[model samples]
Target: MTARTARAVDVPVAGGVLRVGVWDAAPDAPTILAVHGVTSSHLAWQLLAEELPGVRIVAPDLRGRGQSNAVAGPAGMAAHADDLAAVCAHLDIAPALVVAHSMGAFVAVVFAHRHPALVRRLLLVDGGLPLSAPADLSPDELVAAILGPTAARLSMRFADTAAYLRFWRDHPAFAADWSPELEDYLVYDLVPVADGGAALRPATSYATTVEDTVDMNTRPTVTEALDDLAVPTVLVTVPRGLQNETPGLYPPAHLAALLARYPAVEHVAWPEFNHYTVVLSRRGAARLAELVTAQLSLSVA
Candidate 1:
């Protein structure tokens, strides 16, 4: 679909239909199920999809985000995993190579564990393992602790799409990797909302964000899934974080400890990319494309 232009397909899920963006390849082509970050939509994988033109990438707007924003109820690792399972069943694609970014990585781990027959392997970009934080924090506290300004932005209403684009354009993480394609993804994030006047808001549900963020770091579903996980998996991290600050999501010591605990998951780092750029930027997406091709080779070999 990257070469032919992408299209949307809705698949029924828990509370509503999950909106999936399909990038076409020949029917016989290998498929990649890509999962985006906490607040991101399927469009986050557009660059990566285009890079691997020969691959059919099915990226879904996880319930409570993107076009699936109306999807209701619980939003945790297991819930997201089941939503993914529904998408795969709807497409009749089992044993697909799963490539997930940020919180999506957490979902993939559980998905693979719960539906081992469906996922062949995983390429987790920028997130999957737990972050360094107190285990006793509440979902709201955790969202504030982990997301910081990102969580704050969700409450801010914008006059129009241009204002939202400007908000991201000024972000330190994206300052150097900005592109028109990136703008399209940003625009898609906005949805009209009644906030005192004519205004727009990010489609991501803050309540869902809190629930999922808390579950990723504090709940046993993620860590337990990781403990029992047998699928072949690789985790790739960047040097910078969401705002392009040093150390990124997983600092050296924290990352080393995680690797020691889950030696089954291989680790790799990309010095030139940040958390967001690893999937949204051109050069970073090219590097990711190379990794996907290599993983597909391993899956077949």
Candidate 2:
């Protein structure tokens, strides 16, 4: 009397192989393509998938991360969007509803813009507008500030999964809430090194960081492309920045400006949640599901 586990499949794409995990529950159910943030993998949504009853969930390990790590770069938002499009095409599914968190939101936004016919709706979890970069800060300073000291502490290997998970949990964002699911996720984020110890697989390298940083700061052409897009869109802005310190990184002003431009888009602000937790926390997951399901219901009406 248990449900079936999600199926994992690999699809060949232009750049590299894509590892897609799919839950083919109901053919008529709205297919949700879940995209994780930077420095994360498909495992980010493992809990969300379990929470959604009969929805078909697809999460791909974006290029340069997870099983697609071997898949070399051009790891910008456009590239990631194209990768999602390719996956959808391979599956022969049209007009999928996309749920993307943080940096992944940028990817979904671009995909919806480029292939409007392919994306039925978009639910952005605490990421929508192009991230802004300080004009005066050098790239190095920015990376150091954002990544913290852990950015440069690239070790050849870890003693064990516990070691790596501890390092990951040590982050300021996750220091307080250490869930079992998070531990499992961090464990899979690494691979066994050649020397018999484990290191971060899909290791987020300096080059990858630089490329992601550049992409995050620059205004995506997709934002302009979606000007006339009629697909249902929602932006769930978090209460804080990535560091969880700033109270208004995803402020009402930011969402208001986007709504002013789009006119048809909907916006919601969750004052209780921070950037990462807005999508990862249990309450955040339920809120996201409610918002997305409501959108689906509206479309049916």
lDDT of 2: 0.71
**In terms of TM-score, how similar is model 2 to the real structure?**
0.87
Best by TM-score: 1
Q: For model 2, how does the per-residue alpha-carbon lDDT over 1-301 read when each residue is reduced to its tens digit? A: 1233567889887767988888777778777889987777787876677667677888888877777777875777778888988998898876457888877887888888777778888888877565544566676676665554444643336777777776667676665656776776677667666555444433545566667656666545556656656677887887776666775455556566767877776778788777766666666666777776787677557
**lDDT of each model, Cα atoms only?**
0.90, 0.71
| Per-residue C-alpha lDDT of model 1 across residues 177-272, encoded as one tens digit per residue | 998789999999999995456899999999889888888887799999999989899999998888788878999999999999999999998999
**Residue 261, model 1: Cα distance from true site in angstroms:** 0.9
Against the hidden reference, what TM-scores do the models get?
0.97, 0.87
Clashing pairs in 1: 1-23, 1-24, 95-118
Tell me how candidate 1 scores on lDDT. 0.90
